[model samples]
Structures are given as structure tokens and as C-alpha cells.
Target chain A: GAGVSQSPRYKVAKRGQDVALRCDPISGHVSLFWYQQALGQGPEFLTYFQNEAQLDKSGLPSDRFFAERPEGSVSTLKIQRTQQEDSAVYLCASSSQAFSYNEQFFGPGTRLTVL
Target chain B: TQLLEQSPQFLSIQEGENLTVYCNSSSVFSSLQWYRQEPGEGPVLLVTVVTGGEVKKLKRLTFQFGDARKDSSLHITAAQPGDTGLYLCAGGRSGGYNKLIFGAGTRLAVHP
Candidate 1:
């Protein structure tokens, strides 16, 4: 079975530009999550989706960050007016069920570098 | 905010040596998971411990959950070069949207 997958393995963007990172979750996965990983640090939660409904997004650092999982399968995390601080690896994960106890399958991640 | 603190942020050991990484938190969790990530790759789940005082072993790797469910540990016996990577421990609270709080991670480098 295919695991979660993210596009644009690496992206270099100028500050103030907008970037959208895409995620393809495994088929029939009911839970999806987004996380931000800074260098030398563990991944920080960003948002979550159960099907097409976004269940929680309190972890999003700022208003500049937004995400959507419309249609309940594919998701996207978009950053508006990117800042140098936004540079990090954006990871997407999915689990078969909506329960938090289930193990999440993670994607390779898209490294965004704001220059 | 629930924070998971991992000790020994960085570790370098020779192959065949044993090592242990610890994750501690002030808040209790319903479940804890250990993940291993190599360079340029997303973290791969290693083990999940839900019961207090629980121990699960994967080959030479052993995982333990604290009796209080507030801490966990991973011990590798006879480490190999393939064991080298960032080890992360994540805690999931009992309720909410199933958000996971992750530790800063311990970077392990095993030299053969």
C-alpha cells in the first residue's frame, strides 16, 4: 500500500512570497495531520483533518498559515507572506482511523526555505 | 502547553554498543510513540506504548512506558549503523483531536 506522499521535496522561496505544499494521504485514511519541523527540533503540530472537516488547528503558529483537506483525501498547507522563520520541513501524516492512538504514516515532507 | 523533554540531545556511539534515550513530561499521556527518522525522510514509527509499565521489544530495541505514563524510554542493544538517526518520542493526550506533542528528539550517530 502507498504511504502518505508530499510534493516538491525542496522549495526555496523569497520572503513575502506564498507557498502551498501538497499532501496525498493513503486511500481511506480518515485522519490527516500537518506538522512543522525545524532544524534540530522535533516536529510541531500544525493542523488536523478528519475527512473533509478540519477538527483542530490550534497548533498553527499564526494567521499566515492555513490548511485544507477538501474532499477528505488530499490536503494542502499554505503559507502566506512567508518569513524566514517559516523555513522548515512541512510533514503530512495519515492514520487509518480517527483515533489518536493509531500510528500515523508520515510522508517524506517538503522542505521550505524562505530566502 | 504539554512539552516532552528528551535527554541527551545528541549521541554518538560505536557499533555494537548499547544506548538509551529518554523522554519525560510533566503531564500524563494516554499513549506514547517512538519514531526513527533518517536524513531526508519522514519519521518511521517504531513502537507505541499505551499501558503504564509496559515494555515492547523490536529485535534489539526495547521500549518502555513509565508507570505514570508521563515518560518513556528506548534502549537499543548492540546498536548498528542503521540505527543511526533522529529518535523522537510523541505523547498523545487522552482527549482532544488526537494531537501529538513531540519531543525535540535525540540525534544518534552509530559509527561502525
Candidate 2:
């Protein structure tokens, strides 16, 4: 159980509702990443955090998507005014290295269903 | 946007069969990684190839990176039912960010 852990393995939200998915990376991991995986597709980068500092968020689908990591440990991805398009799985990953080309350990992911 | 195109989006074969999945792109990558994902679970890294024209083997799986680093392939020999899952290829940039550009993935099913 040393790998990354995500909360609310499954979430159901109505359109226009707000939802927050949490991610707890492995201890001592310096790099954390969030990705969105649509049904039948691979995961696409959503955002990245390096020890509480959010470095890159170019992959965020829209301005409604926001993520924050306080104290360099747990991360929370919040979707404001949820849309039906977000009805996919949100994945969290962590790595011990500073760079991304290194190995990253992923969690089971939080599957979100927006109605 | 850099895109990775995967071939044979869905593949089905009997046990003890061989198959190959490919990921191609026009943009060059600093490194390429292969991952296998099961239902409701996150992807697990299978292999990472940094050097162009490099080939790495893991058990019955063989991964090859293109000479131009713009493509890659995964070949499974004598696959078993346990091999059934979604195979994905991801391209990483050299900027030290973990933002990965991933292919759509190849869903493989090996029947017994």
C-alpha cells in the first residue's frame, strides 16, 4: 500500500455541481501529476505539482479545472460547474525524481460520472 | 498539439498467439514509455526507452523505439489470457516535466 492513493474511487455529480478529487502520493515523492483518461483512451496530462508548487497546468482542459497541493503532500483537483464531458477517470501519479522522464507510480484513479 | 497515433485500437487473439501494437507520431520525443492498464486500475509502466533505435524486452514483451524517436512498437509473443489489457505508449519531453503525451491505447484480449 505504499503506492499513491486516490479517494472516492467513484464519484457521481450532477451538471453544474462542484466536485473535488483527492490524491496522496507516496512518501518522499517529489513530483506529482494529475491526468484525465476518457473511456477507451489513454490518460492525458491535466496538471503537475512539485512539492506543493504547481509548475505546469498546460494540459488543463478549461478554466473550470483547478488543482492545489498544500504542504507538498496531498493534492486536490476541483472541478467547478462540472460538465458531462468530465465523465471520465481522473488519475494521480507520483515520482521520486525531480524530472518527468523518470518512473511515475499511479493510483487506482477516481472515476467521475457527471449527469 | 503533439499527438500519438496507435494502431489496431482493439485486438483479439487466441492464447499462444503473437501480436504487435504500434504508436506513431510526427513529433520527436525525448523518451518513450510503454504501460499496461487493467479495468478500473491505473497504468503500470512496462518499459522506458530513452535512446533512439533502442530495444528492450520484458518477459514475452518486446519494445522498440524508432530511430527518429517519433514512433515505437510493442510486440508480444505467445501471449496468454493474462496479457489482456490496454497497452499505451507515452511520449515525454526533455524539459523535466512529467507531463506525458499518450497514445489512445491498444486494447488487447487474448482468449483461452
Candidate 3:
């Protein structure tokens, strides 16, 4: 794909169920990030990955939230035992640099609805 | 706590009018970026300001960063219907891993 892409544009999960969202960043991009956004609000940072190594997970809300980028190109965010408050749009973004001013390109985002 | 705050959460204006959106923060950032997002898509980068007290213009849009690198303002001149969308401001820290701290955002509706 020419830009970042996310799978399952919309997902509905019952409370206490687990869900995994996938992201495919631009080819060869080094930095990947995950964010959660509520309706009519801005994105909140979740985690960050540089290549295949997870560098920052400070923004993850709880121990149930997990993310990984095994190959540096594709990434996944897993939420275990979801709650009602967990409903939000999960966004993925990638940049060409690790910690620079390079522009971060974003994906369409996966809207997760917890029922 | 929200590190950055945006004012006028919702804006509705007529075409050809001008408006300004503000993003304020207490902490400093290495660089600030502006992005526009549609209803069903991702945010697209508009511009980035690296230096404090810097100003950048994109066509009818003008962006300014505060001298302390703690705030930013976006000014749109002669807005059109095409300018309607959610506008976001994100900041990157110098020693961080390029993780963006974002404001709540300002949703602008330019009606023709």
C-alpha cells in the first residue's frame, strides 16, 4: 500500500472479550506508534516501536494493553478483557525516523466498539 | 491530565470568513505539527514548526509556534467549505521516541 493501512476498519467486541488490531505501515519505515481516540476528541498515545523493538509503552492505560512489532513493518495491539470505557478508535502511524522531526503518516484507524 | 488544551471545541463559520484556533500547553516540545483529519480517514500532516517563535504559511493557512515552544496557533484566512474538518495539534519531545502528545482538537465546519 502507498500509505499506512489498518485491518478490520470496524470491530464490535463484547465486554470481557479480547481483541487484536493490526497495522501495516509504509514500507521500510522505522518508527511505528499506536493511539486511542474517543469520539470528538484527539488521539492519545498508547505505545511506540522502533524497528522490532518496543521502546515506549508509557501511554498504555493498563497491564491488559499489549503491542508488538515483530518485524518493524507490521504491528498489532491487543486488549484483554475489554471494558466499556475501552471503546475508541485505534490509530496507527509510522515515520521514517526514530526520534526526529520527520512527518508521521497515519492509517485510517480501526474503530473498536465494546458492547 | 491533558498536556495540551484546545479552545473552541466546535466551530461553525461561513465561507470566506477567517478564524483562529489555539493550542496551549504547560510543557515544552521539540517540535509541533498540525494535522487535518476527515470523518473516516486518518490525520494528514499540514506543517511542522521546529523553532520557537516560528511561523509557517500554507496557502491560506498560517501557523505560529509560541516563543516558549509550549503553544501554537492556527489561522485560516478566507476559509472555504473544503476547510471543514477536525484540526489537530501534536507535539514531539526531544529525548522521546517521537510519540506525539495531542490536543483534544478543534472541529471546524465551514458552511457555504
Candidate 4:
């Protein structure tokens, strides 16, 4: 794809259920970011990956939230024991450069709904 | 806590009208970026200003960074309905970490 792509555009899960969202960043992008956005708010950073390395996960709300990028081109965010508050749009973005000066390309995002 | 605060959380205007959104913070940043996000889509980067007191223009949108690097403003000239979306401001400090802190965001609605 010419741009970042995410799978499972929308997901519905019952409370306490687990869900996984996938992200396919633009080819050759070395920097990938995951963010969670509640309705009517800005995105909150979840994690950051520099190629295959997961350098930061400070924004993950709890231990139940986990993310990984084995090959550096694709990433996944897994949430366990979901709660109502965990329901939000999960977005993934990729940048060509390793520094903040680079522009980021974002995916459409996966909207998770906890019933 | 929100590192950045955006004023006028919501704005509604008729097409062709002009408006401005503000992003403020107490901390200094090395660079600031603005992004616009549509419904069901992720935020798309609009502009990035590295130097304080810098001003950049993109078509009908004009962005200004504060001299102190603690604030910024986005001005739109003759906004159209297509301009309706959520605007976000993010700041990153130096030191190579490059983790961006985002503001609460401003939702703009332009009626045609």
C-alpha cells in the first residue's frame, strides 16, 4: 500500500474480552507510533517502535496493554481484559526518519467498541 | 496531565469565514507540529515549525509558533466545509527521545 494500513477497521468486544489490532506501516519507515483516542479528544501516545525495537511503552494505561513489532514493518497492539474505558480508536503512524523532524504517515485506525 | 492545552475546544462557522485556534503550554519544545484528523481516519500532519517565532502557510491555513516555543496558533483564511475536522498540536523536546506530546485538540465545523 502507498500509505499506512490497519486491519479490522472496527472491532466489537464484550467487557473483559481481549482484542488485537494490526498496523502495516509504509514501506521502509523506521519509526512507528501507536496512540489511543477517546471520542472527542486528541490521540494519546501508547508506544513507539524504532524498526524492530520497542523503545517506549510509557503511555500504555496498564499491564494489560502490550505491543510488538517483530520485523519493523508491521506492529500489533493487544489489549487484554478490556474495560469500558478502554474503548477508543487505536491509531498507528509511521515516519521515515528516526527523529521527530520527520513527517509521520498515519493509518485509518481501528475503532474498538466494548459492549 | 495534558502537556498542551488548546482553546476554543469547539468552533463552528459559516463557509468563507475566518477563524483561529490556539495551543498553549508551560513547557518549551524544540519543534511543534499541527495535524488534522477526519472522522474514522488518523491524524494527518499539517505542518511542523522548528524555529521559534516561525510562521508557515499551507494554502488557506497559516500556522505560527510562539517566540518562547510554549505556544502556537493556527489561522484559517476563508474556511470551507471541507476544512471541518479535528486539529491537534503536538510538541517534542530535544535530547533525541523525540516523543511528541499532544494537545486536547480543537474540533472545527464549517457549514456551507
- Top-DockQ candidate index: 2
Model 2, which residues run further than 4 Å from truth? none
Collision pairs in model 3: none
lDDT (tens digit, per residue) of candidate 2 on B1-112: 4399999999999999999999999999999999999998999999999999999999999999999999999999999999999999999988776578899999999999
Model 3 Cα displacement at A42 (Å)?
0.8
CA RMSD for every model?
A: 1.1, 1.0, 0.9, 1.0
TM-score of candidate 3 on Cα atoms, chains taken together: 0.98
Retained native contacts per candidate, as fractions?
0.73, 0.84, 0.78, 0.62
TM-score per prediction, in order, is 0.97, 0.98, 0.98, 0.97
Q: Of the pair 2 and 4, which is ahead by TM-score?
A: 2
State the lDDT of candidate 3 residue by residue for B25-100, as single tens digits. Answer: 9999999999999998999999999899999999999999999999999999999999999999999888756778
Rank order (by DockQ, best first): 2, 3, 1, 4
- lDDT of each model, Cα atoms only? 0.94, 0.94, 0.94, 0.93
Per residue, candidate 2 scores C-alpha lDDT tens digits across A1-115 of 8999999999999999999999999999999999999988899999989999999898899999999999999999999999999899999999997875789999999999999
- Model 2, position B95, has a per-residue lDDT of 77
Candidate 3: residue A68 Cα off by (Å): 1.2
Model 4 per-residue lDDT tens digits across residues B13-37: 9999999999999999999999999
Can you tell me the DockQ of model 3? 0.80
What interface-residue Cα RMSD does candidate 2 give after superposition?
1.1
| Every prediction: chain A TM-score | 0.98, 0.97, 0.97, 0.98
